[model samples]
Target chain A: AQRVTQPEKLLSVFKGAPVELKCNYSYSGSPELFWYVQYSRQRLQLLLRHISRESIKGFTADLNKGETSFHLKKPFAQEEDSAMYYCALSADRGSTLGRLYFGRGTQLTVWP
Target chain B: DARVTQTPRDKVTEMGQEVTMRCQPILGHNTVFWYRQTMMQGLELLAYFRNRAPLDDSGMPKDRFSAEMPDATLATLKIQPSEPRDSAVYFCASGTGTGTNNEQFFGPGTRLTVL
Candidate 1:
């Protein structure tokens, strides 16, 4: 079974508009959730983590236990925000233990 | 300016040939991870090491793929008898794997193409 799920493969938004990328996960106990971003010709970098409870580049994510979701949100989309976003979780057991299980990723494009 | 570095940024090989990719993790980092990114499956963890010791490689193909950390700074992923399906970008990430600073720093990645 897939541990992390990001439903949207592609999303587009206008500049200055709000944008949200949906992510959901399944885990029994507490899990560490993180969002990573990759820009063109660049390496993947950490955008933010739920544990840190901080926002980066105007983006924030909240982990909802009841819904099992950790959605990334931004108030205003910028052209620089146009990149691939991946939702990931670190498990505590088996193959996933101490390692991250990443979602397929959502490519967000912000149009001017 | 400590960052993960990978060698052979791009590789073009033939099917059934052996392919090897190398990574140099950030100095003092305790964990190193290998991942494969493709159009269909996205990013998949192939293997990971903690403190220069292999912790898990279950995500890798048992017969064809092998991963190892020769030292704290060096990690390698090798594929024997490569297939066209093995073509993808391979990334190596390094992190402290400790409290509050578990964020992984990624390398530029090795783009492989098998013909």
Candidate 2:
């Protein structure tokens, strides 16, 4: 079955510390991956996508097809970066319009 | 600026009552999606439409849940005899393109509570 998994429910980090949110997915065909973030009381927004190869808000994710992973990382976490992050995958099949399958999510708490 | 718009930021209703949620997709966005969010399940896609036509609705409950785009600008999700289990934050999102890489813009979800 196609699935997305985020092993940790919550992660805590101090200001200026390196942060990593793990994401793994299982799909039959080529996978299109994305990272979305939601700030407190805000709507969900796109953070980055594997194809873009662009970093957003000092965050970058690398798609490792061999490992079937697209983990988000930032060298120095900021207090403002604390938010709920979700990893999503869209299947490769062309028959259907893109449908996002999201992991439960990881809540990153950055403390001073 | 382009953004999806959803109505009734919050709703409280009794079971077995009809519930309607509406969404207005950004102009030029051909695809619209309905999703349900909960603390436990995160986000689950309930239905998707493109070009004012139904593409897929397999994720929704056929008996009680119905999703439609009566016109290009308006999309609605209706639940008849809604149950307690149906209580959730429903989100509407839209994107301009067709592929998986198309970035979707989401509206502030409607939080539904069943009493």
Candidate 3:
């Protein structure tokens, strides 16, 4: 079975501090990992994908195949970065589709 | 900016009532997905359609839940005889269904409450 696990339900950090949101996955084949963020009063949107290797909003996530983890990290947390973050894994059964397995999500609180 | 759109931002109904949620995918997107989210379950994919045809609905409850794409632009998820346990936020997403990183664009979502 394919699964994404976000161990922390809430992560609190002060501004200028480094933040890391842990995510682990279980899959038999090569997995495509993504981080989606949902802000208050805003729609859920993609934050970053491992394939892109691009950092969005000062956040970056690296997929560690040996560890089966794709943890999201930021050098300096900002108050506006506080939101609900979800780690997802694509089905990747051959075609490009939207059957993504999502984790329970972690709420990051960046306090000033 | 293109985005997926859903109808009835919020709905409250009694048990055994029928509930229908609609979604309009972003123009030109070929894949549409339905997902249910709750505090306990997080997010679960219920069904998905490609090219206006249902490719998989195995995640959805067959007895009461039905998902359909009337056309390329419109998709619907209906739950007949809804129960309290069915209450959750339903999200609709659209994607191109091509390339290596086919990211999905999600709608605002519909909050359903069953009494």
Candidate 4:
């Protein structure tokens, strides 16, 4: 059973504060991890992937294998960064390949 | 910029009514996906296609939900005799699996309401 878990339903922070959205996974093998964000009135878009190792809009996520976690982090939160974020996983090789399993999602709100 | 597009951004219909949602994947993308999102479920993948062929629709309700890709650029998801539980924002997404990423590009989605 492959699952993605986002523990927080809602998180709030002030501008310039650091934030972390926690995510955990249960997969048999090395699964691809991703973070998707949906801003208000906008379509969902890829924020970052574990393989890319690229930070988009100052947000970065590191996959920790030991803990089976892929937590999204930002050193300084901005008001524009507030959005609904989802943690997703896909098997690298299997019948379920390319099929994404998404977490329940965490809604982040940054107040100015 | 290339983007996946979905029609009928919003729909309000009574229970047991049939509803059809349309999607236009980005040109040249081989994979298309249909998903339903709700406050309770978050996001659920109903079905997906590759090369205009149905690969997996196991996530969809077999009796009332169906998805088809009539062409490379067009995909549709139909719900026959929809129920109140089916009311949610349905999204269409397209992607090309380039290496290990396979990042999906999503559409604005169809917000369906059932009474």
A best-first ranking of the candidates according to their DockQ comes to: 4, 2, 3, 1
Query: In model 2, which residue pairs have backbone atoms overlapping below 3 Å?
Result: none
Alpha carbon RMSD to native, model 3: 1.7
Candidate 4 C-alpha lDDT tens digits along A29-65: 8878999999986789988999989999999999999
The alpha-carbon deviation from the true structure for residue A108 of candidate 2, after best TM-score superposition, in angstroms, is 1.6
Off by over 4 Å in 3: A94-98
Error of 3 at A110 (Å): 1.8
lDDT of 2 at A108: 96
Q: DockQ of each model against the real complex? A: 0.56, 0.63, 0.58, 0.64
Better of 1 and 4 by DockQ: 4
lDDT of 1 by residue, B1-115 (tens): 8889999999999999999999999998888999999989899988889888888888899899999888887999999989999999999999876434468899999999999
For model 3 chain B, give the 10-residue run with minimal summed lDDT: B95-104
Candidate 4, residue B86: the lDDT equals 93
Q: Which predicted model would earn the best lDDT?
A: 4
Candidate 4 chain A minimal-lDDT segment of 10 residues: A90-99
State every prediction's TM-score relative to the real structure: 0.94, 0.94, 0.94, 0.95
Off by over 4 Å in 1: A92-97, B98-100
Model 4, span B27-60: residue lDDT tens:
9888899999998889888998888888889889
Cα lDDT tens digits for candidate 1, A18-83: 999999998886778999999986899999999989889999999999999999999999999999
